[model samples]
Target chain A: MTIEEESGYRGKAEEFLQVFKKGAEFTQDLLRENERLRYRVLELENSLNSATAGSGPDSQSQALIQRISELEQEKKAILDRIQQIEDENQDFANRYVEIEAENNNLANLYIASYQLHSTLDFKEVLQIIMEIVINLIGAEEFALMLLDEKSGDLQAVACEGLDRDEVPPVKLGSGLIGQTLQSGESYFTDDLESYQRDILNPMVCVPLKIKDHVIGVLSIYKLLLQKDQFAQVDYELFTLLAGHAATAIFGARLYSDSERRLSTIQGFLDLLTK
Target chain B: MADYNILIVEDSPTMRQLISFALKRIRGVRIVEASDGVDGLKKISAEKFDMIFTDINMPVMDGLKLISLVRDEPNHKGVPIVVITTEGAQEDRQRALALGANDYITKPIQPNKILDVAKQLLKLA
Candidate 1:
């Protein structure tokens, strides 16, 4: 072995050892720098968390949210209340209209009753009955038939929308009108839309009665063109006419007979005096 | 004294009474009745009327003829005339309108309808 060769190998080994030591020192410095940077990043994250906790979702905002929710509920309740009031108002309006109609019907009944007994003359009573039939009952074709007690037949005394001769005598208990008079009950057709005039089958037959003693029958063959059906007030008028008309007619007839007798007596007295 | 003077021309006393009764509901209004169109025309000639309600089937003179005659007069041309027609008498209603009737109410009249017509014609509240 040569000494020079051994010495050169030993110097190269020392230089290699120095370079390894320097590399270890640089690795240690880099690890220290990395640990310091990691701690600094952790501190900054913790501060950010603290700042967010301080600023977000405070007590005032929670109260405001609850208040807003309550306000929404209150608004909904108010809207519901308004709707209820509107429904009630609509009902009241409808009721008002109905009441008005009823009032008018009552007024019509009052007027009809007042006019029926406004006169006592035979002709005037008949005229009033005709008017009542035309205006109140809305009868276009009708006849007032008085029963001939001895003959057992009803003879038409007055007629409207028809000639007096056109209305033939109705026998007792024969047709609708006669039956109504015999029974002392009124007869009315339920459906008048398809009604066709038949003398035996009248649209309406009201018996003129005085305490269950029927004297005549008011036969309605046809109604006014506008009146296809009778109203509630019409039935009321019929009821009124049944009693008041009978009394009025009977009184008028008695008055007429008495007047005629009085005139005859006056004439006799005048002849005796002359 | 009345604020308005209205006339009703009808043959039936019942109808005249009904119309008068309805008209009485209005405040400060006077109602005058005539039995026929001829009588109505005489009254109209004598006095100025605010409104007139007439039946179409009146005797002596029909409502259409009366409306035409009233329109012929210079003073009564502006007066409002309302005709009462039967439900099926559309021809009569049209003729009345053509003859210068302002409006028409049907027979079997509701008093409210009459008042509505009166209010509209008189521009009342």
Candidate 2:
């Protein structure tokens, strides 16, 4: 062959060899990409399996926690129920204490009234009255004085923690007790010094009336070191005890007068028979 | 000799009864019933049962224990044992196989399916 023709042929062979080299490189690149894709797919599958495996425990734990929370709520409800029961128990206990106290007071009052039935002497009746009044009102001192209705004068019948000489012989319209008798109504004074020159501290004077007639007066006195300590409840309780005293004293007097009249009649009959 | 004498070991009263009923329907079958693995072992000691169909969860002892015990027995060295249970996990299947269980069947046990497995294991058809 000629030199030019031979050079052209060699150039064509070189061009073919370059194309074959490019094709081989492209095939190798494709194989490498295919291998990468296969590896990536395997990794994805493994990750999916691992994720599912991991989620299993998470779901189980969540379910367990949910069950535990439900149990805890039930426990809280039980605790609340127990607390409510305790509150009810406390309420019942307080009511029981109050009822017990009232029962004791009624028992004491019954005993005092029973003693009045056995006694006809005014002194004995007065002593019982003072005891009942002091216990009922929880007072420091108490006094009962009767009025001579004909002379319009008051005479002290029973005095507790006070000297008979110190207490003046009061008229119907003169002192605090006398004023109560005259008014025929109950009167309460927080400070005796506010109402009277001689008397000191808080005092209560209740007139003893039988059938609209003021027969006597009952007076309870307490030193007002703390004035607020005396309340309306104290006044109400004292008035109730005074009413019991009035009934007892009047009944005893009536019984004694009847006994005296019977004795006198018996003595007269004995003389007549002689 | 007969192809297989199958032992059905299960604890559930209903499942055991159902399996017994199904086994009776198949011809040329010698069937034995056991309530649990302990009863199954007793039954196995008394007779030469060819195959064992057992449930995984039972009262006295489980199917896994029965499988392991039966595998250790001299006469049942290569005898096929089938586990039937509600568990379908691959790990459970692998474990049953590892414990010498030849095959596993999941429940709501169809009678025809159990029969098919029995025929295949015994090489009846």
Candidate with the greatest TM-score versus the true structure: 1
lDDT string, candidate 1, A1-274, tens digits: 5899999999999999999999999999999999999999999999999877775667669889999999999999999999999999999999999998887777777777677778779888888888888876778898998888788889988999888898888887888987997799999998888878887778889998899999888888888887878888888888888888888888888899999999999999999999
Sorted into a CAPRI-style docking class, model 2 comes out as incorrect
TM-score of 1: 0.79
Q: What would the TM-score be for candidate 2 when compared with the true structure?
A: 0.47
Across B1-106, the per-residue lDDT of candidate 1 in tens digits comes to: 7899999999988788888888888999999999998999999998889999999998899888999999998878999999987777899999999989999987
Candidate 1: residue pairs that collide: none
Looking at candidate 2 chain B, the ten consecutive residues that score lowest on lDDT are: B12-21
Cα RMSD for predicted model 1: 9.3
Q: Write the per-residue lDDT of candidate 2 for residues A1-274, one digit (tens) a residue.
A: 9999999999999999999999999999999999999999999999999889877877989999999999999999999999999999999999997775454444344554565455777777776666545433444455677877677777777776676565666786777777887788787765555544344221678787775677788776653222335434455545554566667778888888899999999999999999
Best by lDDT: 1
lDDT of 1 at A254: 87
Candidate 2, B1-125: lDDT as tens digits: 55458899976544554455556556777777898999999999998987888888778888778889899999987888888754334566677799999887665444455666777787775
